[model samples]
Target: MERRTAEDRGTGTDGDTAAAPLPGRAAVVIVGGGVLGASVAFHLAEAGVRGVLLLERDTPAAGSSGKPVGGVRAQFSDPLNIRIGRRSLEAWRAFGERPGADIGFAQVGYLFLLGDATERALFEEGVAAQNALGVPSRIIGPAEAAALCPYLDPDSIVAAAHCPTDGYALPREAVAGYLRAAARHGAAIRTHCPVTAIDIRDGALDAVRTPHGTVRTTTVICCAGAWSAEVGAMAGVRLPVTPLRRQIAFTGPLDTPPPRIPFTLDFASTAYFHNDGAGGLLLGMSDPRQQPGFGREFSREWLAPFREAAGRRAPALATLPVSHGWAGLYETTPDHNALIGEAADVPRFLYATGFSGHGFLQAPAVGELIRDLYLGREPFLDIGPLAASRFDGPAGEGNAGHTGARPEAHII
Candidate 1:
């Protein structure tokens, strides 16, 4: 294998991109090249951590990280996650200074549409948490919501929450930025290197075996997205992550582009749409009947339910002709939250996965958190609650340990 200080710079999602001669040894080995892996490697290498090697099964971002566009927001129901979102947004806004890449970040804002009093109340409470953390998000009436996004019907939504600072950025560019920076800092990134096995001895990680070759190391970081469970299993750790297919479609370019609107979502139906940055719109929704698996083939059949939800929420979008689509996997857990913590049984084996669909948005912060872990420093915040060991207890008891799990309410 060749040493890849550069090349293979896709966001750490599906796979593809790089490889040079493989090193026989490394101080650390990162599995998965998705945005999380790239972010983590960048942080570690930037901090002067030596012998860093990031291996990908395919081109970085080839997985879910390679989405057409990724949402970034600080809108969360819990303070802990809100803090994570806030810090990440700051990093994204200043990405050019740190990773030095134009990620095409836009702060058009995020609008969450509430269709009923129950959802309205929940968002009202969430907005308070967000405001306390310095996020300028507010709950607005249907009239104000329709004003912000003219495509919405004031009669359809009872209430809405808008955060003027939240928006999205290019995922593939973000991944390349992080990995390219990591390379400059003396980190080695190799592509086409699927981790076949992890060697453990006496409860400590000894080495990582891949299709290319085995590299001896005491530290291993698992940033694998949908395949995180398989990576965790190689280390005898139980990461209860399941893969689910999420699809999105783009309308053909129009004669008149829709006005640039906040990334909007109909919270009640989980339907959402945003400006494609082209003369079109991007549309998607969660198919309640979607089976949990690694099947990411874009099936137009799912669009039927998406359009049905749009009919009730945004009538105009219901009849919009979709030009093309893409499908990706979401590494979901029982709680639909992320799993970020080191394994208790496996020494120095760290993992930050099961992000469900927030991996790209949370990559920067997760990278910092894992870097702190490898350095034995306290993280910026307590992530102990997101430990996989939480599953050690009975079902629904995932929030019983460490700092205790906070409520994860916002969904799109």
Candidate 2:
């Protein structure tokens, strides 16, 4: 596996024209080369948009896109999220048909455990909503849940909502596919080109000034994730995107790994574990108390609670040593939901950040939505709820500073 770091620089014109000036003016310039940006780039190119450029400050997928747990599910509390995720899932299911390399996708499924009665009721409601949305999911008692996976401890789970149609997608593979397809469709992705400043001319995006050079673009789509607020600030737009830290760990291959196991989420502890499909397991837990910031340091202290919780949920996993662990940042918003649609104040500026943790699964739909906005086509999904104008109002004004909408513990 490639150890994704910030030093993997791409070919450049003497590191001065690193940002690569657009051919006069690009139809669209996407900031950030992560999964979201790649998806948008590919979608835009597929729409026959000429002169599409994707700018990356660091290595592609160096951010959350590379470290994503790849959990794709429709078990969201919000209807819009569910709908968007459902569309993306369908795209993944039909990935082979797309104009890109196969992402090695599989229907590993997802199992979200509920320990408390209140949470259990909420799970039931979510399951019902998912079913109504055509997601094959249902609530199951502890016995039934454990029956599906013999390794599961029946006594540990009070209830669980199982969704066989939802599972993980190889985010790295998917991003690679998008980049290749986008390039084939005439989209150029430039890396090591950090946008130091976004130049606005007469209340519109004029060009982006990068460390390498300036890129003239009419439409600037901010998909910088946690760093979106900083990018927005360049345009003098007070976007409320906050960078939050989320950590994850992986274990060595087991001697006798289970043939198949759903990606299980222990809601009681905000811990999640899943088989890595290579005789290994991946486990993670988020720290709710952790503040939002950009840091990738390892901490041994979080292991104790993680191990204790994992043992209670899957005793066999406790024996496996956590071979490696890494942390990344999630650009979150006040509502813990993504900020999509165009910025009312900035007509040409489209916001696609603040996905919190759901960005990976929603990438496909977001790509389609952004493509529609650029091509003058209808959006694939209803993204009215994720508009940037939501934070422009009085109530949203004060709440924009608040990033407490999503539980930090769910970062894993």
Candidate 3:
């Protein structure tokens, strides 16, 4: 990919000119210009912090932030996730109303179809957990699920969990909004400026080395998404994040598109489909055999399984011609959850990566949590459950008690 700055695309914010050069230092340097990093920068600047520099190896939303199907929801098996989802939903709604940064956020809701007794039980537990956290999600019968999403095959679904306030937002637009807001608040965003190394002295952050120049800063936040592990290594922190490839296919404009349904998912097979909002359907399924790597090439072999799953769950979409599709990486951790906090060993080196597939939807709340951590204030949300220390131990030996069932069960 060609490296280009925000100025090259004429997207530079106020006070940023096309001919401006990168500064030698800043109070805080954020690596990665995706939604997560952009949100952090925006929140920090909005909190009265000055001289904030956000560096992107490529343009904003060039990673998973730009590639997801854009599903947002508050339904989760974990309370932390549910709380974060609730706050993010609020932030998305506020962003949609903000002038000059209207992210097209739609509360189309999310429907998780349960196919069997075990799945139904799990969803019931999830709904209870979500409701306890103030999320208005509940278990609905197959009839109600099918009525809400007419294309679904009621015979195949036993039960489902629905949350009307959950929905989708344009990831690119969210990133743009955050970037513009951050820059307008005196945050300098430098795209295409990748960090080569992080300088550490006496177990503390010293500076950040980049191709453009060395930035002497005491704080650095790694929001590099899939590349977070590599970025963490520079600071001598072993981040347990690996990039998993995921693909999505878009069907051609249908003669009769399905109803404007919620983002529907089959909990058993991890198969999901939703309206693309442009008279087409977007579909994807997790490949059980997919290995961890940076490879994002779309595979023709997976199409057969995708069709089979989609056909079994929503028969009407089985025959639709796939018009186009793309692939992106998911920054997955061992438990398929995010690692968010400052490193215990590496001073001033904070991280917010490893969301598996839900990072974009959770970025808004994470930005505020990170800002709180940096400012030494109590965060609005409890982020202790997502600390990096949870994985601390000998390198090869697994942490037994910590290794439990994955918290985020609805990965699709």
Candidate 4:
């Protein structure tokens, strides 16, 4: 995951596309073909927007979206995120009818294990907030938590937040679905095309340059995950995004299949696991020792700390043999939340990236938000707080009219 260029890999899930070839000019040019980008393309094209061009660095979902085990939940500690999560969940449920593709979505639910009283109290508040937002998440005792996932060590967990609506799905399938629908609606999706340069003249978008050719477009939406900072720079907009590597290991087919369970996480250690729905389990953790960078090579060394954390929470999973693993980039920002809003300085450039780890779940709703923003329609939610200018601090004369760092407050 470099600055401008995209990784040269996609899952090739994109089936036959009734899309167009590269055009000299387009009404809207989208950079990045991941789930978020593909969603935006579908929403915009479905809205009858013509001349829409989506350029992907590689195939769609070749980035982080193709790697991680998709966890969809609305049990956020904040209202904004919970709303986004809830809305996206509803959209994911209705995806098959409108998008005309099956995403393998399962509402197997999400369980967050809390280790201490402090964490318990925090989750109680989150559960209340989720309830208000129509998310049926409840704070339960360790006994109930262990009942849902038999592998859990009941003594290790003090409390848990369980949301039956939250679940896991296929990320690459969702991306391919969106791209296919977008293409059907007259959106040209060009793979292996990265936006090398963005030309802005007199504080307005001019064109987007790539290796294939340059396309003239006034509206450019950036869904580039880890490499959004460089795209922002080319357009004179500041998007402070960084890439951090996150890894996951898979236990190959086992003689005894794992019990059907929720996507469980040990909040204190950030350790998590889920049944692959195929005979084994997928295990992972946010390694605290990992330094932020573009290094995405999966390493067994991190498994040492992972096992320590997983062992403390679930004694049975600590000794599971890891058949294979992979490392992917988590596009992180200053606050570990997402960057979703139009740039005030460069109005033509709208961005939706830097989703610490919530991008997959929030993509569906964010697509509608971006589509509404581009169409000058009032979106269902007030996304003013998510403006990139929030990090700029004070709308001063020399600061290019940034909205000032008002703290988006989990506006993912």
Candidate 5:
């Protein structure tokens, strides 16, 4: 993959240039330049912590962060997820008003369509859970849902969970904003620098070895996204994240685009689509047949299934022409949730990965959470439920029990 920095994308900088010389040592070494890593660096610097080094093999947002559909929402099945989503949404809203960041965030809303009784029940439960966390999400009947998003085929959906505060943002902008801010706050970002190994001494993190040089740091955080497992292995800690290929297609400009609608999802099929801010529509769906790997090549085979599913849920887009398509990896876990906090077995080694497909949306809250964990401060939200220690059984006997974790149905 080609290495491109935020400067290449023309995102304003906070005065410090990126791709600086790899230093011999630092207080903390963040191995990854995606949004999550950048967020951690930015928050740490903002909190008065200095000498932080952020390394990226490619560039900021070059991984999953760059390819995401950029949906931000607070409607989640779990209470922790809902709380994190709410906090993340608040940060997204404040980005534009803050220094060096305007993520082009829009609150067009999100609507998950429920087709059957079981789907309706699950969605209702999810909505109640979200509401209890102060998220303004509700289960609306088909008619109300259709009123909110007229493009949806009401007959195909029995009920829908709608959250008006949920929407999308520009991932690249967010990454660039964080990098620039981190740089200004005395953090160094190095692109095209990959950590080859994690040095551990006496069961404690010693340093990070890279091609350029070895960074002697006691604290290391892995935000490598899909490649987290490989990075963790260098430190003798096994991560359960698997890289799953996800594809998305964009429609050509429409003569008459549908009214500004929420990011719509067919909960049963996981088929989803939303406006691209341009006149076109962005659409995608998970391929059940897709095997976990690093394959990021787009496939024509997925187009037909996505179209068919979209047509059934949103008849208005049945015949829309797909002008272009792209593929990205989703660092999925057994529970379809993120693994946050310090690794129980690896002292001085922290983690903020395994977000399944929700990393980009949750990066803001995650950045803060990781900063809190690293600094030994009270985190804004209790992240015990997301610890990597949850899968301590047969499934994790060899690879840290990541395979034993349960699957989350609310994915997508």
Candidate 6:
């Protein structure tokens, strides 16, 4: 895999030509050039939203989307996530063929193991929901699970859910493909132009103020991901999005790597490891009490959980030293779900943030949903539970004893 560094791309200063007003105007303005923003730009342009302008504080794919573990799976506990993942997988399949870059999309399948009866029940419910949505997921016995992944210890797994359609996609390649295709379709995407503030009056968005200059557009879509709260605050809306740091590590290449298989998540151990498609392993796990910030600074200490979990699940990695690591943030919400759809007050302003840790794999479906919103059409999947207004008024259920979306103790 090609690692993207700061030196390879411009520092988002390429288009900073004086703080002059932008010429004419765009029908839609998208903030943040990461996967979510790029997908929206591409889809908006495809939906006939001409002169769509996308602004990024840095170069494209320089945020969480660039540094994510690039694992795609439809094996989610929530029905909405399953729908989104399925749609995204469909788009990825087509995207792999007609692309400027070959996004390494592989449907090696996913193995979500269960440790106890309660966990097995949850997995079964999730698998049923997936089946109802036309997703190809099923509950498999321990024997079947071991058959699918020979290295797995059947004795450790109480039950398992397997989804052959669950897969992975190279992040940068997907972003580049969408950007190039969107550019060809007539969208003007600009990087390094950070939107400093948003102009709002009467609870409606007027325009966006960026470092370069003010860009006037009738509609604005906020896809800032980890920095979504900052953009929402510009319009006087206290979005519930919060940034939480996460870390991932890579192992040295193995002489005889395990056979290619889909990503596996050991729920009991809170462990996840997958083949890097090059004889190495890519792994990650979440810290129960991780700090909330945008800075990439991380400690080597975060590797403890991953190392322990890997050793417990796959002892072969006991001697493998961590080659390198990457740090990123998860834009979280009160429900641990995304904040999609238009805000109740900010009429022309739409958002797609708070994806938790599933942004990279879910980008394709998110783009299509945003496109539907812009075209005055209903989203392919219901987005009612993710609106910004769901957090409004007296703070209702949230402040009055309702527990927020706590991360699963097992899987981060």
Candidate achieving higher TM-score, 2 or 6:
2
Deviating ranges (above 4 Å) for candidate 3: 1-19, 98-100, 394-408
TM-score of each: 0.94, 0.90, 0.93, 0.91, 0.92, 0.89
* Runs of candidate 6 exceeding 4 Å displacement: 1-24, 97-101, 393-412
**At residue 327, what lDDT does model 1 achieve?**
93
Tens digit per residue, CA lDDT, model 2, 1-412: 5443321222211132244554556778899988899899989998888888888887678788988788887777645667888999998888878955678787888888777688788777777777888888888899987876666788877788899888898887888778777877888778777889888888888888876667787789999988898888888776788887788887878767765778888887877888786778877877766787897676756777877887887676666787887887877777677888786777788878888888898899999998888777877666776777677767885353333232422334
Q: How well does candidate 3 score on lDDT at residue 73?
A: 82
**lDDT for residue 74 in candidate 6, whole number 0-100:** 69
Error of 1 at 389 (Å): 0.5
Q: Provide the RMSD of all predictions against the true structure, rounded to 1 decimal.
A: 3.1, 4.2, 3.2, 5.5, 3.6, 4.2
Indicate whether candidate 1 or candidate 3 has the larger lDDT.
Answer: 1
Model 4, position 200, has a per-residue lDDT of 85
- What is each predicted model's overall lDDT from 0 to 1? 0.86, 0.77, 0.83, 0.83, 0.83, 0.75
Clashing pairs for predicted structure model 5, backbone only: 396-401
Q: After superposition, how far is residue 45 of candidate 1 from its true place, in Å?
A: 0.4
User: Model 2 scores what on Cα lDDT?
Assistant: 0.77
Superposition error at 367 for model 2 (Å):
0.4
Positional deviation of residue 56's Cα in model 2 after best superposition, in angstroms: 0.7
Candidate 1: list runs displaced more than 4 Å.
Answer: 1-19, 396-410
Which candidate, 1 or 6, has the higher TM-score?
A: 1
lDDT of 3 by residue, 50-80 (tens): 9899988777888888899888888888777
Quote the positional error of residue 36 for candidate 3 in Å.
0.3
Which of the numbered candidates is closest to the native, going by highest TM-score? 1
Model 2 clash count equals: 1
For residues 247-342, could you state the per-residue lDDT of candidate 1 as single tens digits?
A: 999997977789999999988778899999888999988888999998888879988988888888789888899899999988888777788988
Largest lDDT belongs to which candidate? 1
lDDT of 1 at 52: 96
